[model samples]
Target: MGSINYDDSDVLDVLIIGAGISGINAAYRLHDELPDKKYLILENREQLGGTWDLFKYPGIRSDSDLHTFGYAFKEWTGADIAEGKEILTYLKKVAADNGIEERIRYKTRVNSADWSTEERCWFVSTEQDGQQKQYRSRFLYTCTGYYDYDAALKADIPGIQNFKGKVVHPQFWDLKEDDYRGKRVAVIGSGATAITLIPSMAEVTKDITLVQRSPTYILSLEKYDPIAKVLRAVLPQKMAAFVIRQKNIARIYASYHIFRTFPGVAKKILGRLTSMQLPKDIPLDPHFKPNYNPWDQRLCICPDGDFYKTLREGKAHIATGHIDQVTNNEIILKNGERIPCDIIVTATGLKLHVGGKIATSVDKKLIKASERFVWKGCMIEGLPNYALSIGYTNASWTLGSDCTAQYVVRMIKHMDKYHKSMVVPEPSNRDQLEEGPLLDLTSTYVKKAEKDLPKAATTGPWRMRTNYWYDLVQAKYGGYDELVFQ
Candidate 1:
């Protein structure tokens, strides 16, 4: 790729990519802590709130509770569980309230970022509309997330082209033109998208057939206040926020520990609860069962028993079997059953990629991300002045991102104090240690990026722990002194 035009008018202290929650929070922290330093937020989209703005599907609500998701300094005064639009609105408000909206450059996509050892800065190339521009910054932070915005997985079944009806993917939903009202639809996947979309679309569509190879463990929750409301009213905002966050974090961690320590006992308790919600005739054996324990993958959460209620009402049906092939207007199952539909929605998971196609190079030599071990899943070992904001698969993405961002700010502050130009994580024994894949084998993103990416250490949180509290203890407060900076 040719180099973009250089216009180095303003040399920034930090250049953040993707103005989503992570990037925004990072900017906020940097500005708050070090107001003298200059920073810029470059976003690919016309608007902020990366994932929230990208996904406009029906019933697009948060999987986790909102209190933990929002900023620690700013209290989430809205409802407990916020919808997609509400979240987007809140993000915009945050930018506006902080007076950082003007600092963001919209519709500008970063092509590549290269680090120079001599200058100790990053050369960032970005394209806006049809024009290209370049800049240099002391620090670089990526919050692009793992998935591709424009791409969605298409079903690989034979004769998919022969289908006469309109096919859609939730990732690429058309806001105008097409409608699913009063039409028979078949949604594929057992992930969060499929779980949330199936029951919701069933309300408008004539019938919805949920096709899945296996089952996902679903839990029901309600947006109500018995004690939280009383506490919030009685106590101060900061105090209330701290109390609620602590309580929720403890509860979630304890439950997860129980599930991990005693699988059989946890399964029995969870299985009984799930059985009580669903129909007795529905097979709970292998279909609704998982090979791994709960929280291994992510457990799908729903508000109330909407998913089960939809199934019981006969408006929606869950087909737990392998999809053999696509035959014109129907899907043929491996068990010799044909389910006909007018519209097919493939909510089949997302593809995960690190840095969102932004290549990293050191001294003109291309550095493969998969070849490096992640330091707290943010900084790559041996890379200078760069950090990534990736989220937890089990917990809310913002929770992990926020903690990591704070640590990065602190590190930067320390660098400023010591008069250090760059900070890199260099391993002591690069030859003795071997690297492994960053994610589990079952994750679609890991499978896709396995060949080209940096290999993270197989052990520790860099390889495993998806819990927020655990990551907080380890990354934020535990190993700070040990982290080397040069």
Candidate 2:
């Protein structure tokens, strides 16, 4: 791929941060829809694919099916719950085929961006290969995910420091360097990471234990979708992919709504399904039953019922209780049970960090995102010509992000047609607007970082977004009368 020439004098139309799934989608949209616009993707890492490239944990896969998670422009016929490597490969292929790969500048870390009212452009400072560099752009779009890549949320288990065995966080796991063969492994936390690790490491380790304070709602999904297979065999490839994607999208949207609308019924349905997978000896009262209602937090997905199968086979076990402490060779629980293990995998959670900690300012005045509101769940209030991609918590991330990319493109096109240089969201009714969280998730990581993210509204364009169908329609045809375009 050809490299983008660094020229401080040349002002690009857009400067996108991160080469993750969102950034790639943004680049594709800009190139395909607005071909005349010059944009560049700045990735701090040496490779693209963001999370897919960053996490090398065993049995790492998408919780959401790939049909919805995959790009709308691209058709994915692979397994619904795609593995990490396959997802990375798909991302690379999308970038390559679309000519977006050449426009990406790897190892370029953006530090700060300041908007100049007088110049009507942004001056961005970055560090590449230890050399400070500068660039100018008319608009800035952040696709860096809402998590701190440099650090994982620390596990709070008491006496963890005193444990004389190998301790690992899934975020930083090395399959080759960290060996777990024939050793007893204790995975802490009941989230997606913990469940994924249990099934993947079960065959290698003598026994893997899932140690959690409480149970998380787990759902079993078929690895391969028969509907997709039947459609592919009958319809054309592209048409089949499109239909399958939409079907999955509707399925998830309906499921989420059903779960939220009828919590008791949803719980019973999930419980019955889970009971069929687990062995009768292991009851569903404490270990499998979650105290909270369904969809209170994102449900953990086990592909092909592997998580339960591993448990039924006696290779994986679950222990639900508060951890009292960790001895040199055992994890002591509050219930007076000791779990002997050689390795402790902390699949605790992520630490949310938005905008990659890029210091943003307007006219030399510092802009704090936490103090502002999100406009249309894409742009920040009072921030000119800026957009950020945040995906849906209830469905595939790409569905939300793809809409965001489309929305940004629409905004840019509107600006171009109207000959406007800057566009920012400033509602005249800001004072009367009710404040809410941009992310609706109740997960520990989200709650911990609630104060650090942009606030959401209860109504209008500034309202919190969850439904992709609504967002898709809004992104294409939503009114921008509330925005101040100049």
Candidate 3:
């Protein structure tokens, strides 16, 4: 196919926003399944691996095991749970190996995408370094995972600006020269970022205090990928891939079962294991206990109890209290205790935006995402020739996302046979459909948008199932006949 001109007539088969893991995988699947289609992956950043490239704080690693976190087609050859840098490298390798790197347009941010009813195409506008460009495509796939582009920083806290010390947020860490060696530091928030950063920074910092509003449940697990590596070595590549996938699915389901069937037993076991790692007298009550069940929100994971070990060794301290306000040189707690620090790191959670908050319009009528039902968590009701690769909060993100991508490929192939130009979710009776929140409100992202988000049917895998195996079976291999296409 010849390169089309840059005008309105330049039509593409697919236009993917966000060159992150989801977009990358979707592009790979498209290339492998339908080689004739033209696709482009647009990313705002100069590089690939969106979040992994953006976050470079200490002790950055996968919260879930690599067996499940890694790509379905690609086996994770590493021996342990992969770190951020390794994952980035793996992503780059995947792009190179699949020859999909050329399709990516970096430093290009999508501004808006409007569906043109007359043309039956999406008119996409993007800006790159102050210059605006436009493209039209038959399908627009949004893979921008949740999380706003801006880091969540609370720099407006009282006296925070007056502090005559170095201050930073993990999301905006500078890679050039700022060092934390032998300096007193206070890390705020107790989410995965804080849990990972505090213990890792404590090794170099003279003293570290972890300040939190509420306690988060932290669990530790071994990171070895022995079975993954062994299978890759002993069996054929395809067979090894199948074996690893089965093992990972089983492990994921076991954990899910434990959390569902025996909450008390699972909690007790996890708490006991945590207590065994902490200091003898450290209060585990209001400080370490969580109000909700595990996986309701993401359970904080630390490999090998590193955070507890750091606290026990006096290198780190957990301040299980509320922050009254920040003073010039210290953080005052609600109980009136003041902790002095030379540096403060705010590990506050991220704000999630679905489809990167892309503005969509049909026939110049603005389409509100919240008003439409999510079809398989990818395509939306009334939207045609479009799908997203959104992940579940409770499982490895890659697993669900990969499943969604595979489904998209299947749907596209099915469309190819009929010479179809578009696909959309069939309208369902609103009164008959059961409704519930699309995401748990406890999650920082979900809470922010709870008021305006679309409600899902309380039944069906597309509605509420967060399990990996069930989702794979239903989304990847089932329901192609049911989806409406034209």
Candidate topping TM-score: 2
Worst 10 residues of 2 by lDDT: 1-10
**lDDT against the true structure, each candidate:** 0.77, 0.90, 0.78
Stretches of candidate 3 above 4 Å error? 1-9, 151-162, 175-178, 226-238, 480-483
Which candidate, 1 or 3, would have the higher lDDT against the true structure?
A: 3
Clashing pairs in 3: none
Error of 3 at 339 (Å): 1.9
**lDDT tens per residue, model 1, 19-39:** 888888887887777777778
Pairs clashing within candidate 1: 369-454, 370-453, 370-454, 370-455, 371-454, 382-425
RMSD (Cα, Å) of model 3: 2.7
**Model 2 C-alpha lDDT per residue in residues 213-237, reported as the tens digit of each score:** 9999999899999889999999999
Tens-digit lDDT track for model 3 on 1-486?
233223333698889898888888898888887777888888999999988998889878888777678788787767446789998999999998887788888988887888886787999888877889998998899999877776563434556777788888888887332377888888888898988988788878888888887888888766666677788889998788778877877877788668868888777877887778888767787668877777677788888778888888988988877788887889998888787998888887776667776778777787888877777777877778888777877777888788788888888877778888778886446567777777754855567766566556676533854777777777667875335767
Among all candidates shown, the one with the greatest lDDT? 2
